[model samples]
Target: MIDRRRVLKALSKYPVYSPPFHNSEAVLSRSEIAANYNYFLEQKARRLEFLASYLRHFFVELSLSPEALPALDNWLLRYGGHLIPNGGEVLFAMNDYEPAWVGEYHGVNIIHDISIFAGDYIVMKNDKVRWSVNYGDGTKRDYEEIGFGQPCLVGLSHFAYTGNYSIFHGIYEFCYAGLRRLRNGGRGSKWERDIPGELVRRLNYLADPDPPPQIPVSQLTIDD
Candidate 1:
């Protein structure tokens, strides 16, 4: 069981940010020089814990058993795509991974985090990323090269909201679906490879040119 009070208390503090992310680079550097070296480390651990607890809270609230959830480390190692800093927000690769973080910016509390799902068919063509389409607005954007650990927003995302269980549940279902597909010898797309099940139904849908027409049961001829 997660302590909601603990999470809320942590959120009450000023958010700490660091390198390979947004403004955290400076924070990390400054802390390393001025503050105790362990200060940043402590902050990092706190952030990870709060985020994990936040997700766990939702899992329980949605009636999902704790056993049904994978360990955070295992989950991230398996499906964690990449983390990229966008302005003041950090974007996570997988759908259900987004967690709420409270930070102080210019004397105000700000929540920073996001989740991005790329296109099903995005590919690199001619030294440029082709087939990249915004999953939300359907707009297209091109990128020459994506940096390591940087986010590519060639798809849609639900940005910076207190966790929504329905969305998480949907992702969980896709992951479960991917597992079932894997058991049946189906391979997922590059993005789906880590999390597997998202593309199974989509691929099946695309494979069939025409779906059988529906007929009313009353119109069926009786064999007997």
Candidate 2:
């Protein structure tokens, strides 16, 4: 479990700033760093325990196997489509024969980390994204809407280009506090009370999530 105090202590030493996602260079830089990422991925698995015990509703797992690549790939297309730093470096490409996700999930966090310090690393990071690059499919629920990671990724992008980490603080406060509330059985838990069973039911069916058909009692049959 990530000690709340640790996350809080890490966050306390920062101040907020207006996100620089509007600046073309910053957005492009964030994506570029995210795309060709290669570090600290193993750290993400540390979050799974807390997520499972405290926020079991959102916990979903994908068993890794060389043969199961197709399913993992398909799920990635939907989960990834827009957030993929590289259009071609699909999830499978990032993994090998290792039977675990290892550090794969850490890429975004690495991107998040780099986006906070005040500096421009993109020139060396991705010369191709020299000025700007358009992203997302022009819809209400694009990447950021999909998860808090996207916004944190952008917030760090804002911090990196502008030298401020408060954007990280505000967004994280909302997400973390919500998680804490659910953990402590506090207020604002109506949604959690309502959706966990449904989430587990659906996730359990990840291989093929088809709804069961309804039938009248008269049609029911017992097997001996």
Alpha-carbon TM-score of each model against the true structure: 0.24, 0.25
Q: Which 10 residues in a row give candidate 1 its minimum summed lDDT?
A: 106-115
Tens digits of per-residue lDDT, candidate 2, 1-224, equal: 33333333333322222122222222234454343222223323433332223222213333222232334233222222122232232222122111121222222222233222101222223222222222444555433322222222221222122222222232222333344454565444444323223222222222122324545555675421
Over 154-221, each residue of candidate 1 has an lDDT whose tens digit, in order, gives 22222221121122222333434444444444554455434533333332222233424445566675
- Alpha-carbon local distance difference test for all models: 0.29, 0.28
* Highest-scoring model, TM-score: 2
What is the lDDT, from 0 to 100, of the residue 72 in candidate 2? 27
TM-score of structure candidate 2:
0.25
Task: Identify the runs in model 1 with alpha carbons over 4 angstroms from their true place.
Answer: 1-37, 60-188, 192-194, 197-224
